[model samples]
Target: MSEETTRGRAAVSGVAWRRRWRVPEKYRTKGTARPEGGGRSAGGDAPAPIRQWPLLLVLATTLVGLVVTLADFRIGLLIVGGALLTGAVLRAWLPAVGMLAVRSRFTDVVTYAVLGTAVVLLTLMAEPRPWLEVPFLSDILRFSVD
Candidate 1:
């Protein structure tokens, strides 16, 4: 082919190359960037006007449990319901800790566990099932026969 024709073909190919995306050198191996914020980068960074989602989930779950309890619900509802109450309480208190600059995920987990335990204890105490009883196994009786 003549020089002019060759140059034209090359130019066309270069344009086509540009049209196709080329991975930048930096991202050739690794993945996406972490959020640029200091602590707990929001999956969504809109001003959360009300309770955070974890808190809300907890609240919803808890409310469901309460409904079940009133409607003569099941054990799952009670357990999950107690959990939700714990969550609501955590939602209330977590931000307070965060205000002191301890907003790490670990702290969040520990707080949730402790609060959830308390909630469970309170619920058990609040009202217990009539049929639920601690069984004493009489089969293996230990008597001070001496």
Candidate 2:
């Protein structure tokens, strides 16, 4: 390809990337934060920062699971697994996930669902007694213990 054509392609790609990932201009200025209403407002009426409620709920669930771990490992596993699965569902279905919407929607959904599934499977086969048997996972777990 000619140098001029390559440069033109690069410029076009750059514009696409910026449009996809750049923070909105309203969010750029610290002094004029966009309120929940999502419009520019005078300093006197600036709205509160938008909170990522789904992310907060996930964090709370995980913390509760950690606390429960002190009493019973299996129950803790169940709690954490449920939390992760809930997160996956939210990420997959919600149009706007607030701060939790980090990457592209498809990527985020896949990541959440995969991680949640793994956690659920591991929890079911966790120690104190395996609730579901996966031959490969059992072999790996035994190998690690030995």
Candidate 3:
């Protein structure tokens, strides 16, 4: 490709990348302290500082998994539950333990644990039911303003 076209493609791709990953948006540089009024306020839908989400996500995952696992299944449940707990705890705390780029482990643990728990609960509950719903979409919207 010609130099101009190559530069144009690169610039366009950069925009796509920035939009796809809200954290590294064009206006805000990653790893720098966010401006006081830049992102969504504490009460808004804007992503929380990278500092907060993992622990929160981990705790939620732990609770959800604990509930579903407890609600169903009669065999070796404790062992499985404990393993999920370990993953959730790891997700929640590991970042603080060893500084990292983002708090995604919490999501990973929750994804695995929750999905697994759901399958087990459905399989064994005999009359499967949701322990919780998707949570308040409004609450999430309220959190992402900036």
Best by TM-score: 2
What is the per-residue lDDT of model 2 for residues 21-96, given as tens digits with 9 covering 90 to 100? Answer: 9898887867744222222112324333334566777778989998998898878867887887787787777655
What's the ranking of the predictions by TM-score, best on top?
Answer: 2, 1, 3
Largest lDDT belongs to which candidate? Answer: 2
List candidate 1 segments past 4 Å from native.
Answer: 1-51, 73-77, 80-111, 118-146
Clashes of each: 0, 0, 11
Each model's lDDT comes to 0.52, 0.72, 0.51
lDDT tens digits by residue: candidate 1, 16-99:
998787878887867754322223323345455232445455657767777667766455456664674465455445443221
- The list of candidate 2 runs beyond 4 A from truth reads 1-50, 136-146
Estimate the Cα RMSD of every predicted model relative to the unseen true structure. Answer: 18.4, 11.6, 15.8
Better of 1 and 2 by lDDT: 2
Better of 2 and 3 by TM-score: 2
Question: On lDDT, who's better, 1 or 3?
Answer: 1
Indicate the worst ten consecutive residues by lDDT in candidate 2: 34-43
State the displacement of the C-alpha of residue 106, model 3, in Å, after optimal TM-score superposition.
4.0
